[model samples]
Target: MLSLLLVALLAGSGAIGVAAANDAEREDKPGGAATSQGPRNRSAFSNPSGNLSFARQLDFKLGDGVFRKLWVAAPSSTRSSDGLGPLFNARACQACHLKDGRGRPPGPEEQPSSLLFALARPDGSPDPVYGKQLQTFAIQGFAAEASVQISHKPRVITLADGLRVTLQQPQYELRELAYGPIDPTTTLSPRIAPPMIGVGLLELIPEADILARADPDDKDGDGIRGRAHMVASPTNNGRQMLGRFGWKANTASIADQSATAFLNDMGLSTPLFRDGFGDCTAAQSACRAAPDGADDDGMEVPQKLFDLTVFYARNLAVPAREGIGAPAVRRGQKLFSDIGCAACHVPRQVTGASEELPELANQVIWPYTDLLLHDMGDELADPGTPGDSRDGRLWRTPPLWGLGLTRRVNDHDFLLHDGRADGVLQAILWHGGEAAKARDRVIALRKVDRDALLAFLESL
Candidate 1:
């Protein structure tokens, strides 16, 4: 909040000279508090904070190596990068989060890559056979958990102005079960990779600041109820903390998220997760017995490499806003608030001091997210429970800072958890439950107003 006030003060003092304008412009950088825009092109998503120290920049590059390094099966000379999959979805972190942007669901003629199937039984336990995530790939001499086939059922929704939008409803079928037939009642959820920009700033946002936005019981009775997701902290010995990352806000810290990704996405073990046989349950004997590439440090990914990767993920800058001063974008910004979108997508937050990464401390940012979970109703709900305080119908409000650059960075505009929504409007049309009123407001808007609203989102 103080950061915003400083920007306002500088704007008010026109006599302060050119330096004031430059500082105001810097404040407008979208990575917010830590905005770093580089070259303004397809590679815009990849950069450390512009304000980062020279020493820290070297660390960022080191982490980038680990993020993009390809892993292999054990018993290879490349022990540092070995221990890929007994069962896994990808061989590297960059596979899903390409260029640190979002991952899309497989197209009709393409095989699935970045998308993963999270499997669970009726009582929220991992499937007895496939474990937690279905792995379609395995190392040499190992059997993958299963093969997944996806088909889409087309559906249409008409807005108030007679605009008909077609939406895809994905249907998944598990085939070629490596461990025999799965339980008939097993549930599945699709988790598409989210863009990795300004997450470090999100991590630094004070818990008190986030909690202050929560209206768990809708005490004001505005028909909007948002609550923080409490999850077991893997780094803190399972102590409950506000969940900040993941589709359901199922993880508390960036460390947990990075560690989990290494193990779950790549089947590579880290100090936090010592298992080289990632996601392979006891029943999957062949997978568990697969050779492990534990280095002298005793984990597939040593502590230093693991920490470096997390550092890389934590500092990916948010792309700068484009055309913020345009008339349509200005109008859209107002309508965004008028339609109640800002209630959940709060525009401004200030980070508390951070001893670990001082660059992230004490800055104003506009990430346009509350980082809280809200029930999105039936249409958006997944088939399975996500975690504690999370069910089929709830999801964390994703930040909108770098949203406009999604097309440039990932080369596709697919959005939402499953990459089902073709663009921003469709994503809004799909909103329900707490966002039902916002959806109705957008539907009733005049075409001009709707266009302006979209323009405002694009400016982000």
Candidate 2:
């Protein structure tokens, strides 16, 4: 009768599809069994995998202490945690990545802390005054590079159903410059800190698998050409390695990324970047002459401490999907693939044998990113010059595994590189180049269908 017809329509529309995805995941993939799942809690995104051994768990605790520990200015009593800044952004990693969650652009009357600015010239050289990053904080007696100011302009997009969503385009202003006026042609990129979950799992994704998914030349003619970023690896004597971290995919591994953050964000040198005077170019004479935190090991962040912090970063677990059993989410999951979003946001990935952490190996995890660079076109591109030497139009595919918990964990709902789009839908509307067709499909969706897709995303 009427009930039977309803069931048939529901089945046709993928009402029961999510069970299949979940059922397949029942293979008991150790790390794949999503680590954090429950009602919202402060520690939701800050748990170690329950599968770790007692000794390994202690190691995670050690790394957590280092990760959250605040660095003091050099010549302090605490020699191990000294060497904060001649010029820097935040004192601790937790300051930027609050609660191991995403960072947003500053709100009204708030100074930028979790966010940092990148300064580069048109010829791919660092600015003479600002160097590479603009640091807004400094130790005693030293002037910070600049003060950051942000304001938003609203760009409203009306959907097919007459629903209007206002997206905020961020305007960055640099004031109280310590050195001099910036070059007229200098390009500025403001980066909001991304979530820290599942970084180790993403790192463990086999290089071969990443390469297999790359279609740099668009040989398949799908208009989705994802290319791996090649960057000089500091760990490998500057040999070329696939860039897997950062907005531009410019960082090779978790170790390199952590070291870069320590040096650039906190002005604390690590074993990789051994200079005690962080990102200070020769022009900044005061910064060059500043005291360092180097102890008996001759490095600010000693090798063992550096490795412990990297381990902490590598093992943070991805939160489990919340509403996978919901019919609306199932439909949206199916629709996500049908609309070609999966071409770039490749959902399922298996980790290879991990030489560093074996607990992260062979898990059928869903990170929802190819970790490849895609051309997002000019709208999202940084004005003037490329952020790195890479194309101005390109950005690395950010993972979507912990996205649903973003607002819950971070208390704000900003998305994208600079936290421009207010939420996920605006982020989708901002997509272009390789993802244009997918964006078009989302724009053209019925209100119910769009709701379903958003439901699916929220379930993630």
Candidate 3:
């Protein structure tokens, strides 16, 4: 029996339907057979997929080594680990994605390691001197691009029940400019490294299934228009494919994402990005002239090593949902649908066939995202880049699996692209544009109902 209020809420928000209250009492494993049954602690996100075969486990371990391997300056005795950076953010993939979980913005006076700045012009061009990303670290002979400082301004919102929740709005500034002043019009978008859970399964989701959910014109008048981000596939010879990864859905594959990070974050050239200087612009001549770590193949990271890192990233398992049978969590699940959050934060998706990794094939999983681009409104928008007209306003809906383990795995619960929101509640509060109607519903909920909603989210 549905409550009249719940039914009206669903109808108004265009939600198809939600499971019965008691249905959640059944054990719900969000990641299908790939879900990790690891202990609920700091190591929760570091486990391999539960269904991975014994032989494949060795490959996962080998990949883990490459992920945590540290790189140093060129001409070092450790030939394989050289080519760190002329200007880079971190020495290793593990440095930014600490403990294989989400990264946090640095506190005042702390130099950013996980949090880095992206520099670009209105036309999506890199800053002439600083290039694409602002690197705060450099090798001995080269100067780091610049240091960054962050400050917070508190903004308080009063809920319908008159409870006040204060959110910290972050302000960023660049200091110690070694490459001279950057272009005045360059947009500085701060990005925090996201978690590495259930990405393999996400990569395996059928493109047709995701495209079927897109309603770009909002012809149904649901006020929720999700559009797919079409990107040129690097492996497919410039063929346009659905962009599945990254904050703006700008990247199409995990392998591509890993290669980009290797170049930009560690200044290590891979087979995909053969630039020895990484993001160093031609304007920085000293960086271009610096010694490189290229091996016989003329790439810092050889193909074999690169493949291992990608495997590690692709196989990080999503942890099983906790506290699902609780009454409050069940109530919250219904409210999540009733309030329209489920419209975009889609609760379930089935991965298509994967010949490469058969364990991930044809499995029902719960990642809680449509993997579509939505206009998130001005509050969350970065500066517009000409490359994509919707660059500023649109963002990919990030998967919500393993979100509840943030504090345990990473010691922080910062959410959103820039890590401004402190917790799930604040993240929801910051939603706008296509999500504004749903955000309003959450704000107007009774305190008990609100608590349940949060409970359901935490259980995911």
Q: Work out the TM-score per prediction.
A: 0.93, 0.92, 0.94
lDDT of 2: 0.81
**Where does candidate 1 have its weakest 10-residue lDDT segment?**
11-20
Candidates arranged by TM-score, highest first: 3, 1, 2
Candidate topping lDDT: 3
1 versus 3: better TM-score goes to: 3
lDDT (tens digit, per residue) of candidate 2 on 1-460: 8766664454323233343354434312224853544344566678776466679889889999999999999999999889888788899999999898888787687767887788888887888877888888889898888887887788887888888888777788888988888877777888889999888888888888898878999998999889988888887888888889988888888999999999999988888998888889888988989999987867889998999999888878876655576789878888998898888887767788865677788776777788998999877886533334447788889988777778888888789988888788999999988888899899889999999999988767
Q: Give one digit per residue, the lDDT tens place, for model 1 in 1-460.
A: 8766776654332112232234435436755547784766788888898788899999999999999999998989887888998788898888999899999998766555689878887788888887888888888787777777888898898877899889887788887888888878788889899999898999998988788778889999998788888889988998998899999898999999998988888888898999988899888888888898888877999999999998998899887776776788777877887798988887766778989988888877778888999989898989996456537888899998878888988999999999988999989988999999999999899899999999989877
Residue 438, candidate 3: alpha-carbon lDDT: 94
Rank all candidate structures by their lDDT, best first, as comma-separated numbers.
3, 1, 2
lDDT of 1 at 84: 90
Q: Candidate 1 regions off by >4 Å?
A: 1-27
lDDT of 1 at 153: 90
In angstroms, give how far residue 190 of model 1 lies from its true place: 0.2
Superposed model 3: Cα runs more than 4 Å off:
1-27
